[model samples]
Target: MSSSIWSSLPFVAIWSVGYWAVHVPHLLFLSLRNTIKPLRPVPQWSYRLSMGTAVLRAVFRYIGALRYQQPLQLTPGRSGDRFVRIAPPADANLFRGVFGAPSAMAKPAPVSAVWSPAPVVAPSSSHPSDGRRRKVVIYAAGGAFVTGFDPEMSSRFTSALVTSEHFGATNLLFVQYRLATRADPFPGGVLDLFTAYQHVLGLGVAPADIVLIGDSAGGNLVLALLRRRAGLLALGRNNSRSGGQDRALAHQPVRHHGRAGSVLGVDAYRPKGKALTQEEEGYISPMDHPFRLETPLYIEAGGAEGLLESIVTFAGQMADVKGNRVQFHITEDMPHDFFVAYPFIGAKKESCEALKRAKLFLEG
Candidate 1:
């Protein structure tokens, strides 16, 4: 609720409480009805979640918070691993990693002297993956790009992943990429992810040992980064003249609530108020131009998700790629990002099963 209000008007949060208080009972009633007569199999609390999320979506889209970069507290929770802040990769490593060294590379972002330091979630110290430990999960948090590290869902979901012996991840790096609302969209998040990946490499973790994990919009960025790493899409300065790598860096959404929630999400892919062109839409959607890639992937989607059909089709394309390992899982009864609410009341067994599947996929 306060997330949508401007910092200057802190009173709005106080005053808005009365309005929410009045509606609580009504919302609960609706939530109850949803559970009794669910449109599809979902957790009992999911009804309340949907109601709350609808309001949250409106708050972010209507309150205009999406236009600015709000403060972020990158807490690592009780995992005993702190978030490690590292300097952005030098021009040589980032540029040369995705594409051959350029004669001159543009600074994608302002230098540290001019901007705040790069913030990344610290890899697990207790189970550091530096050769001795092995694999690490680079977690990209889902908040529709408006919210960073959604306190509600991310904590529950991530905690389960890290604690589970099934997942067997000793280290996890949660990337604190800039949000679209901060006036950084498209390549901004990907660029930060690339730096995080390289930073982990510098830590002596093997590339094969790294597992990219994300949900919702964060999941999309993970998918894009996978392609970027595989040399399908380059994440660098947008150069319209060059194709594949150079020209490719230029974004195309080429491209969202329940009904309205979907709309709010689409806007996050571009600058505020700016509409997406056809090619730009394509850039954000990996399914649009599915191609061959050797990078292994695990894709999960709800059978009830509007994007389920498309997600399945995309995974099929990836599976067809020669020697590419793909594990696709569908929880037919849950909604999109249902795992975020994880092991909650109604979805406990289902959610745990999903995580177990992910662990097996990664290990195998």
Candidate 2:
């Protein structure tokens, strides 16, 4: 009826629409939370909590009222061996309206007990030879327990030695291990790693001539296996020779190359034996495993990553070992997984340099 009332009608309509846009997702999240009530406790709850937090943050951000900054610091009293739980980024608006309502929680399915063989890319004949066959290098990828191992993130590091300029003559193998959410923690992935290593060794690669490469979590695995080898040696349980019937096979060293190198992708939190409930940290942490051999090691980490503390601790332990040759490379201002971010950040130059350094370390 009145012109003023008519003009005000549009403003009210816009406000109503915007309000629902912000609140509807929150309502759906509440419904999802209810759905998770009957499921067995699994790490999947972590994923749900993360999603919920993201959605809530988005609603606040959309309203121009959310002000939260995730502290980059690690939790106090935690050891460097434990995995860090990072709070989502402060600007959580990125997840708004992106997810659907959580359905009935899926029944906890039995995780496969069988270990699958690690994927091996066939060696190309074009691989140059340095008079003698170059030693093979196996790479394990690092995804802070959740991400990575897809075609893009893994292919580069797995194929680096064979595909890249440095050490292209050398054979390379990429071992894909189970991530945190998919399987029971700790030895689950480690056991898979052992199986893969054994498989590779069975394929005629000499333990003395093989080199292992891993970054971040994969780095942790490399150290874990080495420690297991030492423990086995101490107990005289290094039964690697028992399975081989041939005299030559019986005498082969239990471990390939007798050494391995790891590139530590710094983590934010370090579990000091008691920091977290995760089982992997209990036995596999470099902090808990003493370096027993003169394993030539190359340790590298980005200066800016929060995991530098863990890297430093790992290096210190390795350095204390008698007869160990450990090289530490700390790059300036490179974020976690800088090399893998090459496609998105145009960091190929920096990544190439790091890869070059890594190749040199492995070769030497």
Q: Pick the TM-score winner.
A: 1
Model 1 agreement with the true structure over 1-364: per-residue lDDT tens digits: 2355555465566656655675566556656566664541345436645555444444544444334334454444442335455566665544443222231121244211000112223367664433355556666666665556543245445655554665666655566776664244565666676677667666655566667777777776776676665552344433321121100110001113223544544565554554545433434666656644435566777666666766777778767777767778787656566655454324556656776787666555
lDDT of each: 0.53, 0.44
- Candidate 2, residue 170: how far the Cα is off, in Å: 3.3
For model 2, the local distance difference test gives: 0.44
TM-score of 2: 0.51
Once superposed on the true structure, which residue ranges of model 1 sit more than 4 Å away at CA? Answer: 1-22, 31-70, 74-81, 96-131, 150-157, 232-259, 271-282, 343-348
Q: Taking the tens digit of each residue's C-alpha lDDT, what string does model 2 give over 304-344?
A: 54566656666777678787666677766554454544454
Q: How accurate is candidate 1 locally (lDDT)?
A: 0.53
RMSD of each: 8.0, 19.6
Q: After superposition, how far is residue 205 of candidate 2 from its true place, in Å?
A: 1.3
Candidate 2 stretches with Cα past 4 Å from truth are: 1-134, 151-153, 156-158, 235-282
